[model samples]
Target: MASAFIGSSVKTTKGPSVAGTLAETVAAVSRWGNQPSSEDVEEMIRDSALARHAALVKYLENKLAQAKGKLKKVEKALAKVQENLEPTELPTDLETISDEERFLFRKIGLSMKPYLFLGRRGVFDGTIENMHLHWKYRELVKLIVKRKNIAQVKHIAISLEAESGGVLVSVDKTTQGYAIIVYRGKNYMCPQALRPGNLLTRRQALARSVELQRYEALKHHITDLQERIELVTSELEEMEAGKKFEVHKALYSKFDDGSIPNEDEEGEEEPFSEVEDPKSEEGKLEGQSMIPADCNLRYQAL
Candidate 1:
């Protein structure tokens, strides 16, 4: 069966490009020293750039952690589902009821309200328990099965009788849906534990198997995205650090090489002040190119 939360699952496949955002912030600051600037202004620009980069990195780290948490949860659930799909020893002997007894029980069941409803997850352990509970008070247990054809309903009826130790009385059509009437035989004895080692039929297991495949794909995809994001974030940090070191080296080398006069020689040094920042026309284009077009919509959906 397909996942019920298809819309949400679709969004999870592709999330925000957080690494791209960090790269944009780094690129914006990389152009800082292209023009001559004072030390204080340079320091302020560096601080702003670093702060933004750190924030983006933190956000991506948190996102990665959340994806991992979800993957863990999915894996745990998948394990249980796989266990249910395994083959196990089931009761082979079944109690038989006469035609007269089946007709009488079917009449009784038709007039009574349904005790339980069965959907895609058919013939689980809980259904058997509930059937026993209803049988404790009455001879017949009525079940309504929906969204299934005649063959599937017949399969469910057979599985129910085998698992619950009840006699299959009749499978009838009613206004609500396909109705299954089960008669607890004259020699009925409730088991101490109704929970079976494995209760799902082949069809039910197939449905669950499909759902497991979807989650498996999703887990792997999230892991891939996390790796890519971390790689990009690391590269952005390295570029920022290297750019800052280069700027510092260039400024200090000018003083050491006697290019800028000292205070003793020039009588006084030029007062430190911010310079006129150049227009960064390429920054917008660079950021736009770094982020995927569909990432924003997917992130919002998430």
Candidate 2:
């Protein structure tokens, strides 16, 4: 009976231990099951992806807006360039000049000797009207083109012929300047209005020239800005793809080479020291340093 009882006690203890282990395993399995399901994890991943996609789309939309603005500015600048380049004069039916007619014009034009000067404001309204006034007195007009490039002088000569409705007879290069002899055409009829409506004033011409230069500079600047923007976009794309890109080395290397102004260094003030009154004895002795060494010492002693 004693042996049977001891065996039964051992069995009971072993059974409980086995049961406890199984229960612990069941609780562990339950805890594991309580974790997120694969479908839930996939859904979370999808939501995260959608959020990232939305952010990228927003960034792209902003970039597109900026590009549109820049494009509009570029178009306006180009239109201005075109407008400035076009001749602001009426189109004339120009007939070809014969050699004899040209010779006679040069000879008579040299004799008349009335001159007109063209300055920086090339072929403005004032110049065209002056040419007509000269033509009213004489059949031929002598135009003196000064302070202009050879190409510009040629262009001006052609423009003069067209705008003034005169036949270009001779273009003589002189030490003084280019002598453009133009003949009032064979059927030259004085216009009711001397100055064309489209011709710009001297000031207007100058303003247009300045604007054209500014537009050209702005065009180059815009191109450089676009290039930089493209580089930045490429770098951003690389970063988004978990790739390393050296933006500093590529775009900021020039800035790095230049001396960067340190705010601390620039903001630093010199140490303040109080100055002694010039009327004081010590101040007077210090100020008398140019005097003889003995005199200075004696004054200090005094």
Worst lDDT run of 10 residues, candidate 1, spans 293-302
Give the alpha carbon lDDT tens digit for every residue of 14-80 in model 2: 3445456878888888877767888797556555543544454454445445545655765675465
Error in Å for residue 179 of model 1? 0.2
List the candidates' TM-scores in order.
Answer: 0.40, 0.44
Best by TM-score: 2
RMSD of each: 32.0, 25.4
Question: What TM value does model 1 have?
Answer: 0.40
- Cα lDDT over the full model 1: 0.60
